[model samples]
Target: MTDSTAPRVAIVTGASGGIGRAVAERLAADGVRVVAHYSGNADAAAEVVAAITAGEGEAIAVGGDVADEAAMAALFDAAEQRFGGVDVLVHTAGIMPLGPIAELDLETFDRIQRVNVRGTFVVDQLAARRMRSGGAIINFSTSVTRLQMPTYGAYAASKGAVEAMTLILARELRGRDITVNAVAPGPTATPLFFAGKPQEVVDRIASLNPMERLGTPEDIAEVAAFLAGPGRWVNGQVLYANGGAA
Candidate 1:
């Protein structure tokens, strides 16, 4: 339901690195005015905006915690002040830590839930209120929801909640012509994925997928681009863009 002829103003949260950065760059390249939202990395966020502006694409970096209302308010305000009303909201902010459920501390679990689950809710609620009638909202989930890998219980549970809320929110936006969807990626070769892993271990993990290599942030961003731009009929669907690995 996007106004395809008009410029789509998008707010990409957690855009400082990894999938988020890739999505912001791709959307800007596709002529979508982008607001690259980062939690604390102003430098990284500035770099993204600089790249876009250098290419004559419209972009700005807005710092805020996605789970905080005051911060999100400022984020939305900045988007309107910089461009206009938001037309696309892409929530790519998430975290995954490896620990068996038995060893997972309650504090760590709560923190992860707060960001992964509560942050999505916060962003979606704000986006639902701010986006144009024909806008689209994209949320992130992990293929672990389907794979059920060990040490992913808390993360998957949070995303499972995301899936539920996304569906219900679509119903709430019924006549608005807006669409809400989630993208669940498999093992991707972002910096987060490679961090602290031995090279041999990383290679072994990469080869497990049928693609014979780890997914690139660019690859996930392509799917995000489709959902954010031309993927109108993809309403309320959780698109698994994991190279058929799921």
Candidate 2:
């Protein structure tokens, strides 16, 4: 058991880049020891860990497929062995493949669901069973579920499953003092969002938000930090971190 006075520990999946990287850095800045989980980018993951260490914060990189049950279990074990125990799990590991449901290939749809839906279940299940009390589990969703934009059918469906699972898991952990929630971001300026899009299309989407700009990974990271720290009263909610888009 972790001493009450000890700093909290967190496992941030997909921490190799984008929102996950931002979240891991932010949490470490806030004095939380972080287990940075990456899928395949060892170099990128190591860079994140180096930055954290240079800043005098604690972090380690762990790589694995988020949907793999054994891998996820080992992730949890590593956090426990390294930092005493996990108090927060920010599951930012997912893929976004856009396609219309009518024409989307089954292979693509399956891959998206595997990473987004099954991945959430695998990681969250481990967190729920292993984390100390006062834990916070933040999953990722997308505002596309609300926007219902064309070509986002498969991605939105996967996130919808995420939102549903988040709510149910929160209730199921009743009285555990653990908060379960999801963060749904819209039109973020990440590499993932810019892929295959022209500048004009990107500009159009950015203008749709009331903020009149794309959300930075840091913007979304702020929400994750809050949920993992002082936002204990907030539970079973999907906090949309978009700049008022949708």
Model 1 misplaced regions, further than 4 Å: 1-5
Clashes of each: 0, 0
In candidate 1, what are the lDDT values of residues 1-246, reduced to their tens digit? 445577889999999988999999999999999999999899999999999989899999999888898899899999998787899999998888778899999898998899988999999999888899778999999888998988889889999999998888988898888899999998898888888889998887677678888889999999999988788888988988777777
Can you give the lDDT of residue 226 in candidate 2?
A: 98
Task: Give all candidate RMSDs, comma-separated.
Answer: 1.5, 0.8
Question: Model 2: which residue pairs collide?
Answer: none
Across 1-246, the per-residue lDDT of candidate 2 in tens digits comes to 457799999999999979999999999999999999999999999999999999999999999999999999999889988888999999999999887789999999999999999999999999889989989999999999998899999999999999999999999999899999999999898999999999999999999888999999999999999999999999999999888887
Query: What is the clash count of model 2?
Result: 0
lDDT of 2 at 106: 100
| Candidate 2 worst ten-residue window by lDDT | 1-10
